[model samples]
Target: MDTKFDLEKISQNIVYVKPVVTADLPTEVQDQVGDLDQIYAVHNASGEQLALVADRKLAFHLAREHKMEPVTLH
Candidate 1:
């Protein structure tokens, strides 16, 4: 295996975890979500949204399940 090539691919193998506040969201979205005040947003290194989970642990768990490293964004 090429370690140098693998190292360069690390960025694509990362997932970003961030917190989202339903209260700060649009009223229609907030209403649609129903009682979720806080949630975790998972994104790829390229800034594409991956998933929205209920908690931090689940967010990380999801990344691992998909074989990607999970990282906290801010």
Candidate 2:
């Protein structure tokens, strides 16, 4: 079987990677991450949080896997 992906469409949007303080998160979320002091957050252009990952590298990887460009936010 064969499938097609529209390269242009996939590359149209950009995802931003930001560092989030674990303490600022809710207690449930903090508990989920255990001893992690920080986590990487991936957001869309409108600033909606998409994914919270363990590291910067994984955050970028998540965006690339979805075909969106990744940009760092300090």
Candidate 3:
């Protein structure tokens, strides 16, 4: 049996939006995050984290700016 991973497809055309709470992060991370209660996490189709944005709309806009489609996860 054999399996192949398509790198280009994995990296392209899609992004996932999910919410994360700053308070749930490690203390060092929380300190760096500075007062934001929550954020929208943007990840590539393959689930590699891309960015943490302040709002869901901003996350979507960021994906659009990079020419990738943004989709909400649950």
RMSD of each: 3.0, 6.6, 6.0
State the lDDT of candidate 3 residue by residue for 1-74, as single tens digits.
58898878755888999999988877987887788999889998778989988899999999999889899986
Report the number of the highest-TM-score candidate: 2
Tens digits of per-residue lDDT, candidate 2, 1-74, equal: 57898866754588889999999999999999999999999999888999999999999888989988999999
Model 1 agreement with the true structure over 1-74: per-residue lDDT tens digits: 84556766888799999999988777877777778789888999889989988899999999999999999997
If ranked by TM-score, best first, what sequence of candidates would result?
Answer: 2, 1, 3
- What are the lDDT figures for the candidates, one per model? 0.88, 0.91, 0.87
Report the poorest 10 consecutive residues by lDDT, candidate 1: 1-10
- Per-candidate clashes come to 0, 0, 0
lDDT at position 72, candidate 3: 95
lDDT of 1: 0.88
Model 3 poorest ten-residue lDDT run: 5-14
